[model samples]
Target: MMSKNPNLTLTGPDLAALLCSRVCHDVISPVGAINNGLELLDEGGADSDAMDLIRTSALNASVRLKFARLAFGASGSVGASIDTGEAERAAKDFAVAEKKTEVIWNGPRAIVAKNRVKLLLNLFLVAYSSIPRGGTLELTLENPEFDAKFKIVARGKLMRVPAKFVEITSGQVEEAIDAHSIQPYYTVLLAEECGMELGHSATGEEIIFTAESVSV
Candidate 1:
């Protein structure tokens, strides 16, 4: 008989590349639309409403670009330390228009590992999914050395973890069921690869996921 717990494994670099690709793929269209709108603005006669739309689209594209830098690029990778302020701002920028979720950061500033950066992006995506009607998300990073933990708490009107997400995070599922499904599963896999355990808990109005280092 097969063991109940089979090994879940993935390389950090590999996952980061995949995530970067995914983010780029998703943002390219909106960015292109922004470019197209700008071109239209340059060619079209001046109209207040049309100009407003162009400005709005340009702003949206800019925000998305900044978010992509943090989520997929090296916004957090500078010198030997990651700027917590920059990372927090980048995260907040992404959710600025998202009334459902607010990102709150609480932790000391330190250089986070590349893998940690990737994990944080994935966590942000997961938290985004939990808040469909506006909510607050609190994130705390503890310990930055060999042993580290990231705690994410999402509070909102409907902050319950779906069954499929739980299964994916716990290694109970293996296939991606939908576009919004893979992040959590891959997050858990990344945690496991880094010798960490991803723990999850949910209450009536809150849901929490903690990724902590585990001794091998």
Candidate 2:
């Protein structure tokens, strides 16, 4: 769906800036915890728990940064391929660190273009939002040799598509989109930019997203 209002339509740079702000906002908490841990260590009477805090905080920051590098940053040069294994590992690590989701990659380690990888990661984020009470995020790739197809399924007790997702993807919103809803809105743009079509469905406890490549 396309927006009729020019004010609601976002430019590439404006969307990119919002995504960057979202990533930085997410990273600041863990990074701040690391800094606080360092202060605790430098002060006297630091215990083993302080060391543990520092270790955990560092790991959290690292995992989130790695995942964001692929999901939100420029993970590769233009036209370069990204390692699927690396992307899978990053997603799994992030899920484990968050402790609210379990990411399972049921696909081969075939190299995919960076844009495709970004599209996958963005879809993963969409699925991630569906499960508020922790869930399984199952990622699968089909027909990798030809027109690669990717599916992300989220299953949990309270899995549901976000209202923002419907508004942004279907271009049905009357209000301007803010930072909180920009990620899903950006996911739609990224899919279109990569010449991929995104489809959404939900059944019972599962919310699924499927993306397939097409000629630009």
Per-model tally of clashing residue pairs: 2, 0
Top-scoring candidate (lDDT): 2
**Per-residue accuracy of model 2 over 106-157 as CA lDDT, tens digit each:** 8788887787888888899888988988889999988654588999999998
lDDT of each residue in 59-147, candidate 1, tens digit only: 66677777666655655435334555667777787777433467888888776666666667667767767767778889998885558
lDDT of 1 at 73: 65
Q: Model 2 compared with the native: what TM-score?
A: 0.89
Model 1, position 35, has a per-residue lDDT of 67
The lDDT of model 2 is: 0.82
- Per-candidate local distance difference test: 0.67, 0.82
Name the runs in model 2 displaced over 4 angstroms.
1-8, 42-46, 214-216
Q: How do all models score by TM-score?
A: 0.75, 0.89
Where model 1 places Cα greater than 4 Å from the true spot, the runs are 1-21, 32-46, 73-81, 97-100, 162-164, 174-179
